[model samples]
Target: MAASARIFSSANFNSHVKNVRFQLPCRNRQRLHLRSRQRVSKLSLGSPNQRFLSLTSFANFSPAQFSVSGGCLDRIFFGTKENSCNWNFAPTRISDGPHGGLFDDEKGPEVTVVVLGWLGSKPKHLRRYVEMYNSKGIHAVTFVASVTDVLWFDLGKKLEERIENLAQELAEWLSNSSNGRDRFLMFHTFSNTGWLAYGSILVNLRDRKDLMEKIKGCVVDSGGDPNLDPKVWAAGFTTALLKKNSSAIYPSPDKSTGPQSGNMENGLKTEPKETFSIEPWMLSTFEKLFSYLLNLPFAKEKLLRIVSCLSTDQPHCPQLYLYSSGDKVIPFQAIESFMEQQRRAGKEVWCFNFGPSPHVDHYRTFPDVYTSKLDSFLKKCLSSVASPMPS
Candidate 1:
């Protein structure tokens, strides 16, 4: 028989080892593509829709299971809701970090990883993140849930409903556990979809003071552009804006326009009310570069009330970013814009830019580099995160 053609993926090229496998995509079940209605924003949600997911929700490595090859699978045990590993074709995120074994000490350093990925990304990706963390002795794990296509669907009611599900799941996961490495960190990918969901996570954590306290830092990768990103729907934006957005002020929409003639800085928000406010797609671009959006976001005046934030509310945490020069889906300057804003706000930013590849494919490229950087980032968060531990 023909040796099943040795097919290699983007990940196989960067690293010598191939542990994770992205299965042949099924029907566009969880849509990443979106269509718009004439008056898109006005639709209403009929009845509450339900997509029930439990620990065993992912059965055959289908949309929600991560298949780890080599010895990586042996190092950790995945306790799913069912008796065995089910493939959701996606990945799963569960808890099992550096604060490993027994929690003899009530407090030391604890880390919670909030995993986010592209819209169509399956559960396997989530599991891979957990597995990588486990390998590092990070004692990190995640609660799993599926996300609705807010960017594409723009179904506010649907988005809200899905957000509640994720929030409830997260709250339940952290409700009784008083483990050490309680500090929280977000592991994200994609652009608008993840951030839209993140907005809800913050809203959900608002009432839970303890969970709020555990949030240490974030590692947002390849996302965060709402209005300024020239990519996404505008795939040719690089050239389109190449004629305009001069990287001077606001990046002129056309080259003829002399470098936007006004104050242009970094550290802005994506609020709907700000004059010349940013849109979500642009925010995604900002997430990929400069670790601060290359340029600032919004204006200084609007940041006072934290009014112009993308979130329906604002989440205050020392946030960081990850970007790459090669990612086509998300531009690199977007990350710079993020850091620029963070620095302006007097917050610190820790960035991890792993080489380059298509959109959010860092792991497939330099898995070791990506893992190493995360290890260091979490290590630094140790002493800093445990201070004034939440009682």
Candidate 2:
């Protein structure tokens, strides 16, 4: 990472941590990755899809059964669904001091950047981004959904209600915090899980034109797959189940040995080295199982609604997509096709292909390049706030 990129590093991360503190409920000691493996093994005893559907549909599945890794996971999985405290990845905060770059008084619009994290991502997974935005003097509110939320997104109403509550909070914040000066909202999403949650927020805000006008742009990172294809769903779910590490099952592009030892900003360890390979048959089986689960009538309908909302209900704002040809989870063609569609609809769009970065890990791999592109896009979006860009 270059010196410019290091501007958004551990220092800002710690600053935010100290400012926003929440004492969450006690968590279970058992690690979720271990339990997930055991659950997968148990599924082999019966039809995988049938077993999964039974678990999701039955109200009898205990909190212990769906347990995740830390106190954050316990709060998210077992806490009251409608409580805003349990759902957001981090509490919202405004820029506490002056910033130097694009957001200087006359140069850019005052902006609030809402960052949505990928599926199964913990708060630690999103720390870098919070640092990135907050260091830029931009307010950031980070959010992530549990695997259970994504798995049953449309089948149940809890996630929808939580999203609505989030939207309401954003609306209130924009209204109250503006101080008579123009303030804007920019959405930054990671992977499909965040992208879909972004869509749900759009749905909640559709009827509120005032808040809709406050949205100046969106940045979609490692996402924009706009269909309900089971294969893609299977790939995403598989990655989540294996966890987001760059092991053999989810190796980095170019196959270089990953970082062995280094401390990232915030004292986070570098990615662990690859240790094992996953068999091809496991992916095939998961795909077959998802094909059955996703095709169920109610599930299919909910998925279609999500896809449709993203396509038709989005606000008229500039869009930027950050993705890579090297990503195994999301095919590059899907992103290109989606971008082409947006172009045809006369929407302003920008994209960056970080040639060999892994899904949602572009910043970690190429922080300089990632921050450079993002900085450029944010400048463009703010520059065009009061005027339309020429096609």
Candidate 3:
């Protein structure tokens, strides 16, 4: 993980750090204030392959103490609409890469790798993946949707506005800046939240040619099912059952559905339910919400249509999906079906299975194995973009 030279400084331990803040303060009922600031840079992608593997080995480690040497991009980011998300961009030049040192020149691929996930997403959590990619000279954008943050809140017009507002802000950001959209070449994501936000943004980008051109490929991590797997249900359910956290990612009908659409009954196909403390009432609750939402006009026509950005039937751009076999959050079958569907539709899909990791646990679960695969994916994306294309 620490293949690079080791040097620590007092100010950021040799790393440039930046904290971007965007608050739409209502000075007046009819007005809002928006501000964007850039700091030096933050932590690097720590143990390149081991960060997202999901193990107890990293429990005591601290990335903040590690010094990072780099710069922040002149860019804007969209946080989870719920006002609970954080977006961190760490730019650094690999001192020993193809360009001799760092990739801040036009000769390099104008690459910006954005990580999409939950609002609580921190670079420290994905230090390895981020570090590795940056070491190879690609920019990293880490963001999350605070779906879980607002799950416990009561649904209403305000919630809808909050959700759409986040999406719109991202869209507007891409649409406004110079080379804002075209500058980004590839994306690396972890978990279902990335897709939820990206899928919606793709729909909006259709009208913005500049923004559309920037997104060439996408790598979706743990993007299987939210309301399907039980371990995930248990994790989310624990929040609902104990902390009274809503656990609802997208809008759903059933209060007890608790995300994942209510499928604790079928994890990995062989796991035992004897230990399953789930109740029949939970299933009924999920069906109620799933049935209602699936039937709603907005959901059926608008939501479903917008949500298809992650669908296999979409344009055949390069897409890599890394899912774990042991992921307690999603049934292996669900992701398998998604990959198979995409392959049958003539799209490129890279698939790898992490041996029995926790639900949505990418780092500790399959750190080195997955990151290596991702390294290959990044190289592929870089060549596709950096190399000359024929007419």
Maximum-TM-score candidate? 2
> Candidate 3: global Cα-lDDT?
0.45
Candidate 2 lDDT by residue in tens digits, 1-391 = 1011011123433332212112223322221221123111110122212212111212233324443344433444333232222223222333443323344344444577888878767666777777676666566777767665665464566566656667877787777753465778889998888898898888788888999988988999999999777777767766666654434223344634323213122222234565424424335545655655576678777767877888877778889999877677888799989988888888888998866567887777666667767877777777765332122
* Model 1 C-alpha lDDT per residue in residues 1-391, reported as the tens digit of each score: 1111122334433242132222221111221111111122322221112111212111122334323332221111111222111212112233344423221233544344666544434456567775565543334433322322322222124445445555665566555455533544444434444654565567666777777666665666666654433234233222122212212113212222211212212211122333321223323332332122212333222222122353233345555566565544556676667567667776666776543333455554455556556656665554464432111
**Clashing residue pairs found in predicted model 2:** none
Lowest summed-lDDT stretch of 10 residues in model 3? 70-79
Question: Better model by TM-score, 2 or 3?
Answer: 2
Q: Best to worst by TM-score, what's the order?
A: 2, 3, 1
> Which candidate number has the best lDDT?
2
Worst 10 residues of 1 by lDDT: 31-40
Each model's lDDT: 0.41, 0.62, 0.45
